[model samples]
Target: MDELDEVLPPEVTATLTEQLAGWADGAVTLAPRIGVALVLLGLTALVAWMAGQVLTRLGRRTRLRRNLVDVLRLVSNTAIWLTGLLIAVTVVFPTITPGRALTTLGLGSVAIGFAFKDTFENFLAGILILLREPFRIDDTIECEGAEGRVEAITIRDTHIRQTDGQLVVVPNAQLFHNPVTVRTDQQFRRASIICGVAYGEDVDEARAVIEKAVRAVDLVRDDVRDIQVFAHAFGASSIDFEVTWWTGSLPVDIRASRDQVVAAVKRALDEAGIEIPFPYRTLTVNAPVPIRSVDGQG
Candidate 1:
């Protein structure tokens, strides 16, 4: 030790002694309690970090494991923070009672409930969403007029990827009250398209063209043999025709499929010299007869 002492600066020892003397002699006091609190915090942080690493390793294997990682992280972090807080309370107030602590906790919980009521509700909602399995990740769902594939469901909100590539976050509270429509929940969905043609166009020919268009779609269902194109209506502009098809076990890009079907029908009708007519309103008004008053003031 004496041979290794040369590395220490001479002022280091002097400063150390002066500080210790000051603490011991009551001239000054360093808060050992503060140091101890920091130590406890450091220990909790280390444990939590280690837990995170384990969870991350598991997450790499599967998507389900990835979600579990978030859950484990939350539980581990909360437990560690609670342990640190207990230690802090015990160290700061040596005479504190465990029963009194319980009472305090009860009261604090009530206050916390009032303060973070929405937060707690959302947390519980997340648990229910996971357990009940109303929908799964990547399932196409519609709620509150927003349709998309479910990106993820976290504690606060459920995220979805819209057809337009938008990220939408819907609050759990709203979900609890709102009715959700899971399109891909049963592994299939039906898509329908409405097209109008001129009255002079051959209805059978137009129907054949629509059937061909539906068939041309790669993702369109093969069992769609019940397609019917009727004289839907007599419009001020043109006749309306409806084409419907059934789909099952299809991808989440159903909108794209519908757009494709529409495009195909337009092209097919255009090639057949059939017009998808647009409404043309012509307003006619007659000039009012000149009003003549009995007094003939003009």
Candidate 2:
């Protein structure tokens, strides 16, 4: 140890020399302590990798993993890699005292923290999101005025894919503090379409047609919810009715429901000969007959 002290930094080498005695001699060969530490670190790395694989298998049985399996796989992989890194550090420097370790780590840690502040914040937010589960991975959520399916949640952000073939990434912290709508979790969501008919058309006939159309859809709920047909307004062009139906719309998959129901109702009305009234404009024209009077006299 005394001889080895010559090769090390003054502060650390003196401490190491006093503890190890002849174990770290001036020999060009490696010491048993170092060799053992290396072996332990290697074992830990292998174990960590194995644990990651096990986690992937275990996560499959979980609901979110079943729903967002890819995200779960990624999280497990990250955890294993982090554990392996920490084990490597601990094994390489076994006798580092608490105070000495802190002193050595001080500046580097501060710099690292500053550089990764946003990243760390995002990671912490992701953990909270997983734990709290405000919404699941496949849930239809509304954030920042955009609606979409939650594709994935990572350390820095949450991903969503909208109907328009756009992918949106939201910061993790915003999720913790903002209001989000989870529509997919519900058994059904109420959808309403406003339509207007000519004032002279029978409101009762229109209502009946709409109800029949809504009930015909296989996805519409039959109980605890029903079709709503009510006179919503009396406009200058026509009378309006609000047609509402409860449907098991997939989380973030609303366009399908909207298009299907609207199309069905429109077809039903067309079959029933119910007019979807349009605005009207009246025109009047007057022509002078003085030119015809001369021809009649001739």
Candidate 3:
């Protein structure tokens, strides 16, 4: 090594030595900045997590709907993380300005949005849903042929627990774009069953009997108006009566009330000797005349 250094020119060797010393000095100066940036990033993550938890707890204390609360929490966490990220980036790249940062983020976001269009669409739809409160968590809703109780509403999807015990993850865009039926919007809902009786049965009597029967069902709510029995249609074999009554709007309550009403109606009609006739058809045969053949047979 000594011989090689001696072979090189003294000025070249000194210049190389100075360049290496400068590089080493710059690296030593950069090490602490890198450490500080990492520390800031870690702190930012911790702060974001804590902010999310705090906001979630605060939201629970309010009367806000669950979906709204979740939205607020998510936004808070994102904001906290973004703040931390800005601070971390500034530490690493001191020359970066807010305008430049935003410009870069905007371009990146536009590209990401195009790539994940459906995801952003669902996210925006979810935010709207949260704000509008079309259907809150635990509310029974039907949308796009899917009916269930809302379990959760996230930025991308809605979680529904169907009546049949299946968990459905539906994109928020679908629920937002389509008509959603909030069955439990009101406390009580009207339920009706079409019942028919024999043609010979007295319409008024059948109506009275059905009103009494439906009123007797325990699940049927009587606090509303009186039970209504209207002769809705004239069937081929029987007269149809639309028996309407009020009941709780929940699926379980609706089913139970209907079951009870059906049983009561059947029992009451049987006791009254009122015949609930089955569908019947009648045939008519025309008398045929025999024709004589060409042989002139009588």
Candidate 2 Cα outliers beyond 4 Å, as residue runs:
1-33, 50-95, 102-107, 201-205, 217-219, 251-275, 283-298
lDDT of 1 at 259: 81
lDDT of 2 by residue, 1-298 (tens): 5565667778898776565765646232445546765776677667767766676677666534443444455666666665554555554566664456556667787899899998777777877787677887778888778788889877568898886879999988888778888878786788778888778788899988988887887666758486788999998778888888777767433456667778888899889988888866787558754554655873
lDDT of 3 by residue, 151-231 (tens): 999878999999999999999999999999999898898888999999999999988999998988888888876788999
After the best TM-score superposition of candidate 3, give how far the Cα of residue 27 lies from its true spot, in angstroms: 2.6
Q: Mark the regions of model 1 whose C-alpha exceeds 4 Å error after superposition.
A: 1-46, 61-68, 91-94, 130-133, 136-139, 149-152, 164-167, 184-188, 195-213, 223-241, 247-256, 259-298
How does residue 40 of candidate 2 score in lDDT? 64
Indicate whether candidate 2 or candidate 3 has the larger lDDT: 3
* Candidate No. with top lDDT: 3
Total clashes for model 2:
0
Model 3 quality (TM-score): 0.80
Q: For model 3, what is the error of residue 196's alpha carbon versus the real structure, in angstroms, after optimal superposition?
A: 1.2
Minimal lDDT window, size 10, model 2: 24-33
Per-prediction CA RMSD (Å): 11.0, 7.9, 5.7
- List the global CA lDDT of all models: 0.76, 0.73, 0.87
